[model samples]
Target: MLLNNKEHLNVSEYVDLNLELRNLDLEEKKKLIWPVSKSVDALMNFWNSEPVRSRQGYNDKSECSQLCLGQLCPALYTIMSDGLKPHLGSTFGPIANSVWQVVEASSQQGPLTKTLNDLVQKINGEDFITEGMLKFHAFVFGLLNLRALDAWFAYLCTRESILRKHYNDSSVLTRGRPDEPRPPLPRYPLIE
Candidate 1:
């Protein structure tokens, strides 16, 4: 039986299929799995495909130009091209398209700094409007989340540096500099 009308799934049939899928044996489920290599190859090809690249239409002017994939547009276009739009329509559709507008507006700025500032402001502004009716635009935009990760990394590095310095100082007092180590480690040492 035809389970789809053009692209729309026959929901009742789809539910029945899902129920049938749940009753499958381990071997039957295993037969449905694609090989890992094929999966990876398919993903790589889709990510780097010509049409997706052309749709990105990136014109980076940042100091990290061309190398910087930090911008929002490319990431959105990559994941939401024609093939995936219908699937994402009800879910990611609202948020993605709303963020896309911020990307588009910020792209018009004369300088990279201005563009970034405008983008951030638009996303973070409480008054920001979108067709999707999304609230907390800043949270949805994900730039702030990226910045949080960066900040967390910086904190971790700082903590690591402090710990390394403490270790070196303690080692210097007990033994010597890291380069001028005197004693050999014991075979079954409890602590170094």
Candidate 2:
């Protein structure tokens, strides 16, 4: 768990070492440039991962926080990454890489990189790199490549609608709403 500002500053040397190594790993990852498709694929994987999908709260629209990339709320990345940490490590490399990949792939430098650059400075911060800072980077990265993120969200919404419709249709018999004949399940679009 991450500490608040005061507690983090007083953390032990061992904890500080681990945090340093994690930050270094993230720094090294930022150096690589990935294709937009590769980054999208990685982002989709992170989105579909059990940890992320479970927190989606998809049943109710009001519960939709991290459902789409457009919802770039500050905690979105943290919620997604915290869930992935057990699988992706403390660095949250897969998600971070998605952002870095987009940033590198961009033809023009995006303003969002400023936050990322700031975080680079904070690697040596007295309080050191906090989880919130990492998530902010993720947010900025998502912001930078919103076009790709939007495409994914569009696809996600379409897919969800199809799936929900299919479920409702299938449940017609069980729900005792058999006013109409049952329709076959719709084929999902093949994700490239």
Candidate 3:
């Protein structure tokens, strides 16, 4: 019987499988287990084989991506908890380094400067984000959603602050600023 719509078993089946495995002797468990690299390769192959688009033009790869991400999160957490770093030659190192530059620049100007600066350092040196660095990817993925909202709020706050500054001092000159001159208003307008 199919445990889930997919060929794979669902959570309960996995639990049962785990219980069965736990009951096995050491030698039996060893025989059943595959190497970590084999598991990784299989997951990568699965991801690559998944259809990216359906006949109706809807995204089909989203489910694959979600499945991959689900596997990644726990793996990453485990890697981080174990204090292991990804191999030096992995492709993700350079990409993460480049991104760290942008994050570093943003850190200098933002509200979370200290936190961002610390994060930059964390991603530097031996802690670079590499293809094998699941924890780093997971951490960045977690941050991806908030980065947009943070940028938007920062823009609004900066605009409002500038307006207030101009309002309080008519002699205040806007230099190197992109915004067109406008009348100052309260940061939070009263609802009528």
Candidate 4:
């Protein structure tokens, strides 16, 4: 949760981090190869762990597991340390180490990121962590799988079309005449 704190990381720190990533060694980049594979394995495990059966019978797809913030923090910590940290070296060491500490604290003391007031309002505080874990799993899965990218691109295209249509309609409504025809849509290279 401390990792989520705005005060701990300023704009300059982010800029420095991005610079470090770009300057990272090729050898360090090679180290990241295994983590990418490991992430897929982790995602498969999470997918398998999801309950599939309903009261009546099995379903084609199951809803994602509940958030387990406790489990999620450690899982993310593992992903960062085992998957990303080895490749980052001294560049992201401080941030990685800080995240490790947060993982440890969250595991032992419950959700460290939530405010005291937020925790007090919960009847079963552990459930909150559970929800966080589910969201974390989904996020990680999305990152590891390019399907999310495809979905995002689809969304962008749909939004662009909607906006373009709106703009054309508005222009006609305001001018009392159809505006000059829109330019031909730009063609983008197709990904095989």
Question: Listing every candidate in turn, what is its Cα RMSD in Å to the true structure after a full C-alpha superposition?
Answer: 22.2, 24.6, 25.8, 20.2
True-vs-predicted CA distance for residue 67, candidate 1, Å: 2.3
TM-score, predicted candidate 4 vs. hidden true structure: 0.21
Best by lDDT: 3
Evaluate all candidate structures by whole-model CA lDDT and list the values in order.
Answer: 0.36, 0.38, 0.40, 0.37
Poorest 10 consecutive residues of model 4 by lDDT?
Answer: 168-177
TM-scores for candidates 1 onward, in order:
0.20, 0.19, 0.25, 0.21
Candidate 1 residue spans exceeding 4 A from truth: 1-16, 19-63, 69-73, 80-97, 101-119, 122-146, 149-192
Model 2 stretches with alpha carbons more than 4 Å out: 1-72, 87-148, 152-192
Model 2 lDDT-worst window of ten: 80-89
**lDDT tens digits by residue: candidate 3, 100-172:** 2223344454564555445545555444454434434533453443453235325423554433322222212
Error of 3 at 190 (Å): 84
Better of 1 and 3 by TM-score: 3
lDDT of 1 at 26: 30
lDDT of prediction 3: 0.40
Q: After superposition, how far is residue 114 of candidate 3 from its true place, in Å?
A: 14
What lDDT tens digits, residue by residue, belong to model 2 across residues 47-166? 566764466444533433233333443323332222121222135443333322222333123464454445334433536435544544544544444544444323323343322322
Q: CA lDDT of 126 in candidate 2?
A: 32
Name the top TM-score candidate.
3
What ranges in model 3 sit over 4 Å off? 1-39, 54-61, 83-192
Candidate 1 per-residue lDDT over residues 102-132, each given as its tens digit:
2333334455335355555565464545432
